[model samples]
Target: MDIDARTLRTFREVTLTGSFTQAARRLGYSQSSVTAQMRALERQVGEPVFERLPNGVRLTHSGIVLRDYARQILTLVGEMETALRRPAANPPRLTVGIVPALAYGQQLARVTHIGRRLLSGVQLALRIMGTAEVHDAFKAGAIDGALVLTVVDADDPADLLGEQQYADRSDDLTEVRLQEVEFVPVTGVGRRPGGHGRQVVIADPDCPSQRWLPEFLRLRCDSPPEIHELGSMAGVRAATQSGLGCAMLPTALAADHEEAGGLRPLPGVPRMRWNASLILGRHDTRPAVDRQNLTETLRQATALGRAARPAVPAAEVLGGAGLGGEVLGGGATALDPDTSIAS
Candidate 1:
């Protein structure tokens, strides 16, 4: 069957998003155009690639096979482009998206430095976005990659983006476990006196910490915490520091501020764990060895101190052979960065 690169990319986006409308939006195509492309592809292949459902579509057996081949072909195309490109005075750039939480603290500089070191001459562009927005940007081919959160529980069924078990390592895609952080509720020094208000400081709706923190409060308190939506991580931190409301934050960050008398942990609240991973698409134009080196550099950058309990390795976490595996449970988007600077 005759196939094309653009059509393959459309198919991959549809598979990733599980919706025609979303794929159309990502690819900047009209819904009718996306429909026509799929129809023509189906007619040529003489098989239904997608099992249509009311909510979304699922890949048929044939579609899964096709997806594998498409990935390989597109990966080769990316390699060829990298190999044949002429060198210029200005380096080719890759724009990577991260949530506000990741951009705070020292992570922005750390990642920026690491990206430059690992990729050498390539320019690294960092943009701040909500976690879901980051994923949407990736699907739209607007960004090279993103730092995303997945539940640590491998048995959970909702984590679709969780890495999958693979005997052979992928030359194209590279996933690196950066750090695992604990989410805890924090309140300003004045607010700690009573801790009685329903007001809860939160980031934008897309933030995972916002969702998780409220649920925790609902379970333990007689009344649900009032939602105070701050659009950015810095806003959340500032508001919480001023006693506007208690906010959920990383344990490390909370400790740093509590020591400085700016913020203190909320009484009678438990912390939850979240893992951060750098997700690179298999069809990304970067070289395989460079991707590998980037992953290693990230791993080293995020290494925890000896006094802290060791985070689960990526291999054991995903039930995969090594370095990569699909997350298989409910999706949590991003974690707040708690480092010295946050204090």
Candidate 2:
């Protein structure tokens, strides 16, 4: 309706106050100016916008709809004004969506530390979300980059994590594989390390290992086993500690528990793999300095746990095929470590 910012401002103030005199006073305008603007607004809308009672005013149904649209229009106008007038004054801001695996661990801390060092005067915002949320942020242009963890095969990198799963990879995004965290199946101490009696505890839905673990476990059982869907790795670890189910975790995260006699390794089931990657938008408007620093931050952080872990080959894990072939009912099959770490 060709309304100007001033008129919209007047309309907004009047809606807030529900009184022409109050709105005019709040806006530093005469009541006649407020009335003139409202009359003009009604003419543009071809409907009465307000019912003027003796005490105050009330919005018509049309005015309510216009109020909704006016709020959106005003917001966009404010953003445009800000962008045009103070583009250079904006801080080197980075909005990142990170999986809980990295967000809750030292890896994320390392990233922020390095990010501050590399991109001085940087406004770094870290969002702890799932793979799906990370993808959504990227799609919405709400985030500049992301730290994500996904599952893959050790022997065949492209074998796909379970059939028809979008949890591991997004087709259109750029995923920079940072490091291969060692994956080991763990059960509570003295619990059946392999299938059958063991319930499987997995990271939240869309977690890197969430789908892959269930598929591997079902291979050992005739039907789908009992599954606990935890929303975070800490929950998964806590559940594992309680001897609720078997979980495949990065050795770095599970090593201490295994060593402390609270958890033990499960062997014979195929060793799963996880890919810890930094996902960035293909089209980035970030300053070159900010983008480079973010990439470095993710790279350094993903390496946090991989370096300290001791490597255990497939053969050493319960003879590489369970204590006996009892779990899988197959001959000695050694599953190797090929995973990415996260809390």
Candidate 3:
């Protein structure tokens, strides 16, 4: 039986979302269109694909088998489309979501240069956003891929993206571990002005590095820090520069400001380290192979960014507060694609 790509795509969306109305909302199609497409797909297969229920739908045994093949077929079709449509002169553009804090400094420049040299025809469009925003955007297909720091706790459901749905569907997403990042406590020039608990400035509290920070700090500091939340990394930098207490930031970010006296590392404060990974698509869906290829290029580009920056060892900044070789928690796990970088 010959099945159209659009019908297969609709089927995949329905399978992922579990509800016709929800799939329609995601695909910008009417519920009627979704039902019509599902009917057409079922007719093509000569069997019912979905066991419709009051709350949602479930796939039949035949539907499960079809979805496995459909994912592979769609991936191949996507590759074919790219090969056919890509311009000879201009490379296809890729949208990549990154932690907003990394947007500035030597990292951006180095990544851009590496992309130009290594990625050949592909252009990179980087978006700076918080972790939660990154997850949502990727799920909505707003970005082609992402490099993010996620806290992995085997017991915590939030640590694993779409864990429930991922287990229920055929596994096809690409995940690759890059490298670890060190987080350090930073202040302006000196101690807090009032001698009260240091005011803690954080750009995004939901950032994986920042998630356990308050409790982490309570272990390190005498009094609990007075927390101050800001909207952007720039704002956090500005506030910390004005002696707005202490903040935990990536060593790279703190390194950027150190030479100019914009920030001073708190020598005795604890450090947090987490692994960064390049993830394509959501937990439930596999990314197109072209996107996965671009993801590898992007990781190499960022690795170049790290190498280009002047190295600031974590030991130098953490001083006595360094955890040495210890990791905070068991870091994230990845099911890697066919890439050189190990998970």
Highest lDDT, which number? 2
For residues 1-343, write the lDDT of model 2, one tens digit per residue: 7889779878977886679998786556999999999999999999998988898999999999998898678656654544554446667678888776555455567778766655556678898887667666777878888777654323232322222443345444555556666566777775542332347887656665565566555543435668887767778878888878878776677777778888777654544446666677656666543554466567666777663433333224322344323322123343333321110
TM-score of each model, paired residue for residue: 0.57, 0.58, 0.55
Off by over 4 Å in 3: 1-91, 152-158, 161-174, 193-197, 219-224, 282-289, 304-343
Model 2 clashing residue pairs (backbone) = 181-339, 181-340
How much lDDT does candidate 3 score? 0.62
Scored by Cα lDDT, where does model 2 land? 0.64
Report the lDDT of model 1 for residue 296.
Answer: 42
Worst 10 residues of 2 by lDDT: 334-343
Cα displacement (angstroms), candidate 1, residue 136, comes to 1.7
lDDT of each: 0.61, 0.64, 0.62
lDDT for position 19 in model 1: 89
The positional error of residue 132 in candidate 1, measured at the CA in angstroms, is: 1.7
lDDT of 2 at 45: 93
Off by over 4 Å in 2: 1-90, 151-172, 190-197, 307-332, 335-343
Which ten contiguous residues of candidate 3 have the minimum total lDDT?
334-343
